[model samples]
Target: MRSIVLLASACVVTTSSSVAAAQNPAAIEHHLRYAVRVDGQPDVAMDLLERMRSYHVPGVSIAVIDHDRVVFAKGYGVAAFGGSKSVDSTTLFLAGSISKPVFASGFLRLAEERKISLDADINTLLKSWHLPESKFTEREKVTPRRLLTHSAGLTVWGFPGYALDSAVPSVPQLLDGTPPANTAAVRNDTFPGARWLYSGGGITILQLATTDITGEDFPTLMRRLVLQPAGMMRSTYENPLPMSRRGEAASGHEQIDTPVPGGFHVYPEMAAAGLWTTPSDLARWAIALAHSYRGERGGVLSPAMARQMVSKQMHQQPPYGEGYWGLGVAVIGDGDSLSFSHGGRDEGFVADFFMRPASGRGLVIMMNGVAGGLMGEIERAFAEEYGFGAPPRMTRTIVAKSASELGAYVGRYVGAAGKDTVRFDVSVAPDSKTLQVYNSAGRR
Candidate 1:
């Protein structure tokens, strides 16, 4: 009986809402009604409701932009685990590192206003705190261009954020890795402009710089420069959203659909992971960027500056494709077919947005779960359903190899991960059928 109760409670009965899709009802209905993906040889369409349940995600909100407009923006499932509030188009979710692109846009807007220079040394604009000098900077200085491109050589890959009621640390404390802050010190890990290495820490520096230069708080500055202009009025860089706004926000959850005690975490690292927003709002921002990229009048950036923002700053290796990190967005594909995108992950929340700058077609998906595999599946479905070509189809040839050859690759190794050392053991099956890898704890 207990198992039955648990199973019943775990089941998801999601019904999507098209409150924001009224303007483009047909397009929205078509997208919500059908979810398609390739099943090896043929196309398979699954019910959106069932997919959410199968993935154990509490809720999801999506906004699809096409032909320079948001054709669909809707939400599915409950806002909280075992709760009644339904997620809708207006539901706010953490944008995570997606905050970077928005923040980068603000930076460019500030540049247009002549408040800061992208190529200038960032230390010149920051007054409250400055990057501590290191061997990496002796020959080269960190700039907004490098920082936004993840070539700043800074530390702290990303922030895990703080609990809702926990004491939040100041930006300086976070950068210095002091008390009340969880991550390590945000410092130089390599020479500046050396390569592409993601650093929420580097963005944090920009956050501070923006504040110091503008003489305004990060959120307020962003509103004046980027969000308001881009028509993302519902978005804010504020962390731990105001009490009044909580009701409109989706509560976060674990992969198992268990509610986080507090609806969401408080990300004081606003530039890196803090942004409470809706998919519809993000879609608007994407549309504005697309317009600006085509040398048209955009809300915040000039055409030339917008083009520069999406231009390749550095080359990124495979797994991300022959990708390139632009100012703050990932540029994929080439020439007229290029697209810009970014993914965000915070405790109990995950999100991503993709847009074709030239074509004005893209989608944004936000969910309140730690495990985000469902987002990718939904994206694949969107690609097929809406004809957004180039969903990553794996194409590899399997080859048979001798047992001796496989055995040679099997070995034990040790490596340092953060402050702890870990061991890994690689072994081939006795029957020579497969290989298994084990971590320090020995569980595969």
Candidate 2:
């Protein structure tokens, strides 16, 4: 594969065959300064673009690294869902838990600087509040590492904010499991690190720890420790401040025919979840990670710290490969090809970051839809085009106990999710190897 390095004022970038196909050399070269390295089959990315039109993803941007350079970087869909505004590589979106790895890096930096201790019990840092006296275990022993790996046994998902009808809990009250414990956010049933539960609260606790350390506000500390150090110029921990402050951010949209309003979620717990960044800015951080791993100097973080940041801390993530959760990131795949990847889903947006450190490959994809949106599709297309894995299994097969046993499973039913009921239908097949599931409003 022939690759050309395009130079601009700020940086050098690479473009793959797909990007070169639709745009002229100058246009492709323009993006080379900041984003996109198209190295794979451009023809495959083009096919995926056709399929994305029906999903209402509106806008999409991809950055792929080929060898030492980013060879494929380009935009696929419209920048905004409402009009014909085309998206570019610089488009920004909410990073969701993708913020975790980034935030965890700050903590690791602090640890490396001898300012914080990862093995110390988090209770030592949390000055004011304390966990309840549980019969299961001593909560005082929970450390920062557990919270980082989600071994802290927080909730499976996140806590839904206090609705209009419900009152929100104070941070101390949230940890104590007082009023408005919606089961997603706070629960007395599980002790810290007893099992694997995905809790934003763990990150919130991390937020307070930083607050305690710096005594400055959360946003200010994060700006200093993370945003500034990582060279995430277009990123901020101060989310949803104003469009003026965050120049040229892409507009968020929901899964609707007409434009849906209020594309933002006011995340009180900003450290674990809240981050808005452009793909171009994020590429800086991605490249810094690669450099750190390769023992390059003047990167965002030190080489030793970077290695610790990606180390597999937990094995409980079964059915997903001794699946390892690092400080705040999930490390996937076997040795030599390990990946640090994370995905985020908010009300009106979904974002994903894929980085293969060994090969120096990274990708960022964002869409203005809810869950079940663009990342999976784009990944599938990438895999198919690159021969990483076979095309996704077209047929899904399931083995059920029996027809009579399936009777109990069939129902015009509602999921026992939470306060609200999600209606769906589940019918059993006597032939087995399949279960008919009616598409529900919940899934949509």
Candidate 3:
């Protein structure tokens, strides 16, 4: 069982802290800290190494963008735990769902060239396999626009990736859910263009359609259209990575000490989740996208297409929060506060990147472990250090309670709202003054 410390807040408040206007890259790296700090302990900040150890993350790579340029890129810890090989700016990690926005950028380039229409029925461009017709597609056919915006009502949220020793399925076979394919057949489960529901299955379909239209493989198409133009030389959509580049790849970790079998998994669903890249390369991609958005010439996309790529296409209300879904990224805030962001999670890797194109400021953090929460901590640190706005911190005061008082609040609790229901279990600690809470998922 897991235990979590419970804090009771007497009041809620939001306040911004002021930071130095200018800092060198080395100073910024030295201040790579945590969001939490004791009220009276200004010097008590958790450093990157301490947090990395606490989160069981062996390696972390970071890139910071300022004024539409990459200010600095750095890596910390070893590529694999218990190994001497240290992580550096060139170490590659799986970008996971981060591949979507990158792929979307290339797809938009094709649309700009008049090779494919965003509103056309995807099945029209699909030659090898077709999206099986259903009642959902009777009135509104699935289009590339809806797929990119995640309003196409497709099923299968993600891919699990195959072990290195296993046979990987072709994109078509994976879409058909045939032998060697571990996922279900891609299908429409709800009315088209109804609402936002993420579907990597839809992306796999686009991958096939893109190849069908261009007569070029997905990796080759992306290289020619996006990577080469954006200067992301260290990035690739090639699954299992190429043998010549394996030396630069970081191993995936299941935990602080546990490593994924055979070092890493192989993803044939390249468009959905297979992207091997460095944080520095990702930073360049973001910078290039921002340049195109500003009407800069010689970028991967035209200004008009880049603007559409970052515009809000639909509203997304997840259980945790609410946001707007752009073509391939999540749009946050509005006007001067507007930013586009995406997070990725593979079997043993987690990554995230956010950019405020208006201000030309952003940060990318990629980890070679399943420390998803740690990425948020690092983002908050960057915000505090670099003066970018971050999520509000909820500070609370600790209070001591009697054993009987704590016992009164211990038990199973249930709550319901509309069609949703939640369950939580609370118990008193051995000391009797503290309480531990567990959610329905058995996580604390």
Instruction: List the candidate numbers ranked by lDDT, top first.
Output: 3, 1, 2
Best by lDDT: 3
| For model 3, the run of ten residues with the poorest summed lDDT | 6-15
Each candidate structure's TM-score, on Cα atoms with residue i matched to residue i, is 0.81, 0.73, 0.88
| Candidate 1 lDDT over residue span 28-144, tens digit each | 323332233323534445566677776677888988887888887889888998899999999899888899999998889888897566888888888999888889999998999
Give model 3 RMSD, 1 decimal: 4.8
Local error of candidate 2 at residue 232 (angstroms): 1.6
Winner by TM-score = 3
Q: Which ranges of candidate 1 are over 4 A from the true structure?
A: 1-43, 318-322, 394-444
lDDT of each: 0.77, 0.59, 0.80
lDDT per residue for candidate 3 within 101-168, as digits (tens), equals 99999889987886677999999988888899999999998999999988899888888899998988
1 against 3, candidate with superior lDDT: 3
- Candidate 1 pairs with clashing backbones: none
- Ranked candidates (TM-score, high to low): 3, 1, 2
Error of 2 at 44 (Å): 9.5
Clashing pairs in 3: none
